[model samples]
Target: MNNVKGKLIIIGGAVDKGSFTEVSFDQNVANNLNFFETGIMKRIISESKHGEQSRLEIITTASVIPREVGPEYIKAFAYLNAHNVGVLYIEKREQAHDPEVLERLRNADVVMFTGGDQLRLTSILGGTEFHDILLDKFKNEDFIYAGTSAGAAAASNNMIYQGSSSEALLKGEVKITSGLGLIQDVIIDTHFVQRGRIGRLFQTVVGNPRTIGIGLGEDTGLLITGNGRMEAIGSGLVIIVDGRQIKDTNLTQVELGKPISINNLVVHVMSMYDTYDLHTHQMEIRNSQYSIPLMAEQDSDDADPKVSADDRE
Candidate 1:
């Protein structure tokens, strides 16, 4: 774990995805801006350290429609009073290596990634000078890295590329690839509960017992300070899959395309305001008013859908 002082705001997607103002008929068009506001985005702005003076660089490199996605974030952040925001609309690998783009990234107070394809993000920015600087600033400065959906998914070393919830539990069904290497030894999945991704997350930890699996619900965010401690933020849940203490498993014996069986895979379902100690693998209730619920245990035949194989190599 790096002893860096920077912070990360990994947010789920579709967070406060509001429709056009003229289409929304609830209130005055001007007053309807709240619909576009999201708890996670607001939290990111607050964590920017420089407040109004913050220069945020929106990287839309992951989005297939980088032009469209870039403007959306610029507009959204503008509503939050972030007047100095700029977009890094890099579509190809060569653009990611641009000197001007790298300089902008270095001078920016915060660099945010927009939702799209996580694989595209790593492929384009992987070994470039831009990526090196991003990693350096994240470790040495008080910088904050924020992303939504695919953006959030690309923050870790192990990234879930493509796999549906229905086919998740089966061995090899969940496809994972190398990410941006921002956060190490952890797999992050977005649109968690809303998309029924628990099974996929469970399988990820089972395959790599030492790595942690974080499922960030829509409108939810996990604030990681230092290295292994994370505090839940926003309105949704954060599911933590800890596979370090497995006692038995049929995953190895099962043939390809067969359902996987595991005896004791530890799972923790946490909500907003909950704090988890990644190093200790324990959930710490920051607020004493709430009771600590028993940790969940999963087996092969848990009544949920079983498992499959990943077609994408």
Candidate 2:
């Protein structure tokens, strides 16, 4: 994982661009309205090798409304003074092989995937030469791959395609499929908190205990580095569901519509600036005045352990 040369900015749905209205659950609507207006886009540009001067290609393959979505992003980037941006409306599978499209992808320093249907994204571009080029650039260069909503969900090796939040706990309610395979060992879900999708992730992790479940809230995202370091960004919460400690599960034994049970599933709630180490399965909270590293075990007698922030420095 550390050998990966690219960066991934996986965002939850409805990233604020100062134009659209977003539904809020436990978050302040006013705060979320401006949360990612500049923060997320700025971070995306700064993380790229050439910053704002980098050639950005916005792939609208997942969206049915590419005309509207593409222009919105172009305007959004222009607001941040990023001028070298273009949109690729690859709606068909054969379009993915277009020489012009291939050249644009090859020359781009950053590629942004817009929100739409995840299945459309995988079905059209999964096994094409275009996908091969994308995988190559990501593995060999300092390329940045950023996505929002459905785009974020498809970034993982495994994806949840069909599942309702309310019934996700029932056996067979959550459907899983192979995704773009840009990142591995984890399943990503977007619009998580606001949509009450925690059950969806819980079911996924319960069945695939080896894969971690990342539930991203609206306007929030994770800045994942090559070394497996994930930094929570934006204004809302990011939930990490770890099932490694599970002692048992009844998912396989239950019927299709039956409710399943699992034991010892661990969860971590994170906000902006918090960091989670994918390799270590540890988390460091930054909002607290002192850095509290949550580990599997700690010698401290307190139920919740604490350590001086300076100690980590």
Per-residue CA lDDT of candidate 2, range 188-277, in tens?
999888789999999999988889999999878999989999999888889999999999998889889999899999999999989999
Q: Positional deviation of 105 in candidate 2, in angstroms?
A: 0.3
TM-scores of the models, in the order given: 0.85, 0.87
RMSD for all candidates, in order, please.
13.8, 7.4
Question: Candidate 1: misplaced stretches above 4 Å?
Answer: 15-38, 288-313
- Lowest-sum lDDT 10-residue window in model 2: 18-27
Candidate 2's C-alpha runs over 4 A off are: 15-38, 289-313
Q: What would the C-alpha RMSD of candidate 1 be, to one decimal place?
A: 13.8
| Strongest candidate by lDDT | 2
lDDT of 2: 0.85
